[model samples]
Target: MKNIILLVFFVFHISLFGRNLINPLNKSKDKNFSNIGLYIDGGTFGIGYSTFFNIEKYLSSSKSEKIHLFFRGSYGDVRFLGSGSGGGSFFKNTQTIGASITMITGRGNHHFDSSTGLFYRDESILPLLDLGYRYQKLNGGIILKGKIGILGLGFGMGFSF
Candidate 1:
């Protein structure tokens, strides 16, 4: 079940953003860019494991903001960790796949997952929100980022070109 969802998301990304959406937007500045950065992250809470990462390129839209999109996939192994609701404890893992949109304005960022839900015991689709600040590297790409929400707080490093 997890594998199927991830595969579907990979196909969706290639068809929607990789082949069609971003190319047309980059036709003009095609010569000024090279490659996109890659990222990988994994961490664990008391009884839960979470990971988020993506690889993407930025399509120059205007001078002030950049239109950047990335295919991001996340999987979490969650357990009640301790006594909780109905039962003494519970455990389950969730898989999520979706795309993220970031603005190069340096102030903030946002992302939306078209299909995100849990697997195993409880199942539901819950949209996640990411609020963070990005810093552009002097050479190219992004250097640092920070975001916080129901997912918790995180500090990460990324490359953008």
Candidate 2:
């Protein structure tokens, strides 16, 4: 009786958990899902907001990994002071507009992505690079991201849908 019960339980366990172990690449229908979120970063004293878009699922092939594209716009103020007897204070407004492409790799909701791109600031164009990590819940939960780049380093939290 004990041997029969043990065999039955083993079969039942496999039948219950086997489906969850299937490879994601084997699923044709779920291979192309898109996700969007918002993020914020601060280099200077002012805060910056940007939108994040993931196009990897749509563009991925058997040999390619996930890739994402992002666009950002930010505004901040800078103050400068002169030296010596003729010292004076000056304040200026700063703005930046940029775009980037990132390659993402990891498992489940956690990912590490590295990106390189360009930004238009101070009437000229500048190069920007960032290596970041993010945790995004697929079934609707909290989203978090942190990055370090040429501009500076910052962290952001938001919701994923």
Best-performing candidate as measured by TM-score: 1
Single out the weakest 10-residue window by summed lDDT for candidate 2. Answer: 52-61
Q: What are the Cα lDDT values of the candidates? A: 0.45, 0.46
Query: What lDDT tens digits, residue by residue, belong to model 1 across residues 81-140?
Result: 542234433433344443444444432333221212223223545555555555544236
Residue 12's C-alpha lDDT in candidate 1? Answer: 59
Error of 1 at 8 (Å): 7.0
The total number of steric clashes, by the backbone 3 Å criterion, in model 2 comes to 0
lDDT for 40 in candidate 1 is 50
Superposed Cα deviation of residue 38, candidate 1 (Å): 2.0
* Pairs with backbone N, CA or C atoms under 3 Å apart (clashes), candidate 2: none
TM-score of each: 0.55, 0.54
RMSD of 2: 18.8
